[model samples]
Target: MSWQMADIWENIAQAIPDKPAIVDGDKRYSWAEYEDRAARVAQVYTDHGLKPGAKLAIYSYNSAEYMEAQFGAFKARICPVNVNYRYLEAELTHVINNSDSEALVYQAQFAPRVAAIREQLEHVKLFLEIADGSGEHLDGAVDYETALQAASPMPVIERSDDDLYMLYTGGTTGMPKGVMYDHKTFSSALFTKGFEMREMTLPEGAAGFGPLTQALHAADAATRSIPACPIMHGTGMWIGAMIPHALGGCVVLFDNSHFDPAALWKLTQDEKVTDLTIVGDVFAKPMLAALDDAQAAGKPFDLSSLQMMGSSGVMWSAEVKKGLLEHIEMVIIDSMGSTEGSMGASVTTRETTESDKTASFDMAETTRILTEDGKPVAPGSGDIGLICNGGMVPLGYYKDEKKSAETFRTFDGVRYSIPGDYATVEADGSVTLLGRGSICINSGGEKIFPEEVEEVLKTHDSVYDCLVVGVPDDRFGEKITAVLSVSKGTQFDEGALNDHVRANLAAYKTPRAFITVKDVPRAANGKAGYKDAKEIALNALNLEVA
Candidate 1:
């Protein structure tokens, strides 16, 4: 796994040339076609003076061209920076400029937005547009398809295992920052034994690459994954796109920019998608709703092809898991991971029994629960500790040494990345995750984490979704407020929900006020952007929030 991502793809393509690699809408690309197209993309970009180590920004929806751009950048030994499609013009410009991106590959539909901010991107030299039938083009941009067709497939360039793989994320707080990961570290963690590319090692000689390639091709079944989230997000790109591709499997991309639950189900049924990666309950609610609709209409979509459904980066409640379990017989994988580090823990649930509990995970070997003072917490200690990961962590946040030094650290000579997730190790060796420390509420000197309270609120049948934030308080310093949406026929019984929380958790931890909204605002990836939610709450309370 010390090889660059592009070289590995080349090796896999040589052995399994005809295996389907990517599917977007009606178009399907085989392994050979995928490699060839990626190479052509590489050629075109390199021809335009795109050099190795230069940053290339991908600002588009989920499409085959997105994947091609990613592979192309890797083959050219360039770093691909993921741009949040939801960003406003200022934010988008900030990301591109901050990343020092030399080129951009975006969708034709977004040409206007790109044009509006094109002058702000002083370092950008190339703009390759993917046609979405918008018929709008930038002044100096090249058509993505035309450029690929015109250029020869690039010869494999020199690449290093240490070549950067950059992903920009707004992890837990603040604006987005680029997290730089070398290929070897990212590939090793992603292509684990579970992914069927166990312990990827560089060959002793040229002969060794063949054996690994043959082994990859000899697999009887290939894993097919569909990411319901935008490919720009970590869950979509890493879990949905990269992992499946590394296994010599097919990645199915949703054609629409918006999430269509029915279309997701249809794609899974049609493609026999083995894995569906989502963010959390925002995605689950609609998907579950679609399933209910289909069943009631006497045309239930066949999800029998799915073996597992995984969610990360947000809360995935046990109630939603049970709802999905009733329809599909597959494992529900609830993972605790971050842009700054690899997965710390995972809770896998099957229909047979309740093995996965909400907010609880069996820790990975590379992770440990440590006290703030840097001492490991013993099981059953009941002491709150930060979840720290040892091996396979990112180098650091790109170019922000002070921030990077705070998040990634060396403790007693072993380096660890602590993304500020606080948790308690249970007596049974399970980790019960509290929410991020950055979002924790300190009310009257007692710290209350939002996820713990939110999870308790979700257990009530009347509640559809909820977000807990601390509001400015005169006496208590900050009062806990739960802003939530109720199920369509259920009344907003604040007292009942309050009683439920008081019973499950401490009285002080219960939300002092409950506000009912039509819906909680969520990102496309299904994460409740707490900063925005908090701002909304502050306005409702007539209190100022920082």
Candidate 2:
């Protein structure tokens, strides 16, 4: 109960001072240096008059600095709030104001947006800027490196179990809210996941971490994870960075400004990465294409070192996993979770590929499928219910008691985090994940999950990515629409795609209208952004859906 993230990490740094802690392109930081930098960042927090339980938002891309500030916030007992890098002025302002953040650490490239909304953010007292060579600077913002150089490292202090760790999630369905977790439960679950990833358990307590990490490193079994997505996302921060860091592994970040599959593959090969964190098929498809292209060019990446690739927050199609397996023999892990809590995960390998479906998962004992009336859904019954995670649930959403009570509630005297995700329990106690109930479309009195329809559409040979949304219709009350980004060098046939959907799903579930876009909107966390799709569909529904 006494184990703290920063405290354990400081001891790890003392034990493995010279070991690589983070790798980004040509630069690397050792464990001692990582700790020192984070401490200096904490100094900045202290200097800004931020006290215990104070909140600060991090607005930056994936960099070593992003993580240093997070760890620093932990040491200083400040709540680190993650701001999506893709958010516009309105969305950014809502997150900062909603979270009650007093300080901001932003990348220089995003200075314009910050400066634009800086005046509106009256609660924010400090702005710490990280420079990119882009020469984008903001007035009244403290330069990151300059501050670290000017300030002495803030010494470590005892931290409380109730200290906060906040992750913002809404994923385009609505405005993002900060999901709150106490340090005690969050870090405990994180360490459990990290050790489970290695097929081991924690030795005992904080005292055993130094020896365990040293032995693992000596045995050449240190975890090296690549957070292929933006670190602002929970998947990137929790699974990719914090978990691996807690286990004393070096986190390898992509050096590319944009998502380049070739760059990611080369980074994994160069770093001998043991695991990677991605957001389902959205990332897997492009990465698989890169492997094919690179191999055809007579320069296949050396992916023999990669042991596992994990995806969450979106669909990871079965075919995509098979395609990746064709190139490298690695485990494909699909995790189902949101900022609220982890529901379940499924692992697919070459041998198990035939039996794996895109959305099926094996649940932990703490997770249960419950009906609206507080009864557990019987296995083998075709009943759908909210997938509730029972143990170690979030305290609640920050600053929204109504939402908190609705999301994190007590069902039959046990607290659970049920974020409106509906699913059914199989006879074997596994789950068939339908989708989020909030986004489900009701057409002609029949409910249809968009993810179920989207999965069928993505199976088309011409489709690259697709999002399904319900649009207003006079007859059906709501019409199903498809927003697609076609595959490269291919043309889309709405009729053929509709037929494909009908083949796999019910006729009513098939999209009533089809529209093409250059890109399907997704949150920074790689989850579907349905708002844009609905607007696009409704604007042209009358002309197209007849």
Best by lDDT: 2
How do all models score by TM-score?
0.95, 0.96
State the C-alpha lDDT per candidate. Answer: 0.84, 0.87
TM-score of candidate 1 against the unseen true structure: 0.95
lDDT comparing candidate 2 with the true structure: 0.87
Q: Per-residue lDDT for 342-447 in model 1, tens only? A: 5454645454337667888878788888888799999998999999988878898887998899999888888888989899999998899998999999999999
lDDT per residue for candidate 2 within 1-546, as digits (tens), equals 356778778878988899999997776899999999999999989998999889999988899989899989989999999998888999999999999999999999999999999889968998999988879989988999999989999988988877888898865457898888888788887678667766888755556677778987999888899999888888988888888887889999875357888889988998899999999888899999999999899999999999999888889999999999999998888988887888889989999999988788999668989998779999998888899997659999888899899988788799999899999899998998899988999999999999988888888889999999988788998888899999998888878887788889889999888899989987656688787777777776543433
* Candidate 1 ranges beyond 4 A from true positions: 193-219
All predictions: root-mean-square deviation over Cα? 2.2, 1.9
Locate the minimum summed-lDDT window of 10 residues in model 1.
197-206
